[model samples]
Target: MKPSILTISACGIFTTGIAFAGEQHLTCPARLEPDAIQPNHLPAGWELHMLRPVYLTEGGMLHGPPEESAFLVPDNSTSRKAGKQTREMQHWSFDVPHGYTMWVYCGYGGGGATLKLFQQVTESATECTLSSQSTNGRTKEVLEFSCK
Candidate 1:
């Protein structure tokens, strides 16, 4: 038997149950627009790619204890050319609930030394703050953002 679909509203739809002739409706939460949820204090020159939510498992192995939550914002900025190769620097913003420390890594393309950048934690109730640092001729770098 073919099931009949009924329009409930913009949020969901109703349909006849497959097992029986009973009416069933599926409801979903309203979706929020990107601008409506994005932070107002994003850096001046950086562009927001997307918002990422992170969940850590118990007993953090690589770094810290598990059961930690953090939000990551991956962004793309202007390209910088070092020597003959033009490379894109990696930019990341991290938001953690509690006070925590993180590290950023930068490396050159051709067997060059790697540079480590650190983040300065700024305490705020609504948002996290990330410190801006120059690549200093490095081709790519990872920036750590700590939010308290």
Candidate 2:
């Protein structure tokens, strides 16, 4: 099958559904800057993927009530703004093929932050969600992607 290309605008619009074959590309919003992240580091044949957003609430401070839970669609202006405070919090989804490794580069504050890549045991049409494990106290950051 021919490769599929998917692009997401800074305004949070997706051009097309993800395609599993060939090379797939993902475009970051204009608001985001390029940092240390490089897509060339990813394994071969890996393509950029996007997924729906799911939000969960955690219990507030000691003896505090549970925080409100929210679901994000990742397809509008509001959801993008919510991630402004912490770029990592902004949820990005990707469909990574099994046995393939993808590289994600992220920055926080003045110093650089580390991202831990986790593999989801369950696979659904190669759809997987991508987010920062932590923003490292940085209000602004950049994300770059490259797939093999």
Candidate 3:
């Protein structure tokens, strides 16, 4: 079943942070539009090929990465007080294309996500032959899950 989160109207990776202690926030995917993006906003690390759209994992709205970010630092002071920004994101955004959306997330550090979504390769009318795929795992499973 799709998440009730589908009711949302915008999508993006938004976060809040702390300076030196453990933290938490009320987080959810927001809904948005394609034109909300600027031409230069979709950088390589954020997109597949230049024209490919990245889909958000919730209602699957395509959105850019957060404009602002949050980080953690040592509560006890030192020059370490300035704190380093964390690029090791637990959450990320994928901008959509033509209003089509697909969203994904990993359980932790990308452990649960699979390969990129792709259309199957097909034979060329005048040239191609056959293609074969050999692998250890033949089937991958996606299931409905939630965390409290």
Candidate 4:
């Protein structure tokens, strides 16, 4: 029957598995300056070393053909001191063709620098929020932003 044939065809397609195109990764940093500090801004001392967007696939983030970018930040606030440093990790993510450039500084956090992690939104961005953690504690900053 046609129904039986259709079921067979569907099964065949599913067995083939999906083929993904490709992906990319880029690590960026954000070095904060005195003037850069504002309400809800990145913590003090932490610096961003990489900032980039990347195209992803089924298996995972690809590295070639239709690739993009990714970012990495340094842990400048490893100390438990208050004014010593900003103990935490900061991450930013979005889609909808977002774009941003940076300006690093010379100052470092109270302790030292560590690395942070983040996730991204695809296709479109709405009510985006970059998360941040301090002194290895719970998230402290929720940066509300809009993607262009």
- Name the regions of candidate 1 deviating beyond 4 angstroms: 1-74, 77-89, 105-119, 123-148
- 1-148, model 2: which lDDT tens digit per residue? 3322333344332233233453333323213223222354457888544233212111000111112212224321112334324433333344554554332222222332222111111223222233332143343333323232
What would the TM-scores of all predictions be? 0.23, 0.21, 0.18, 0.20
Among all candidates shown, the one with the greatest lDDT: 1
Candidate 1 residue lDDT tens string, 1-148: 3322323333332333222223111111112133322344568897664343221111100111222323234444455665654444334444444646432221222343221111222222233233223345332232222233
Ranking, TM-score, top scorer first = 1, 2, 4, 3
Candidate 2: Cα lDDT at 103? 29
Clashes of each: 3, 10, 13, 23
* Model 3 per-residue lDDT tens digits across residues 30-56: 222443334445566685232332332
What tens-digit string does per-residue lDDT give for candidate 4 at 27-122?
A: 222222233222334479876433332211001111111113333243221223365233333233422233532211111232223222122322
**Error at 23, model 1, angstroms:** 57
Give the candidate number with the greatest TM-score. 1
* Model 2 TM: 0.21
Identify the runs in model 4 with alpha carbons over 4 angstroms from their true place. Answer: 1-67, 70-119, 136-148
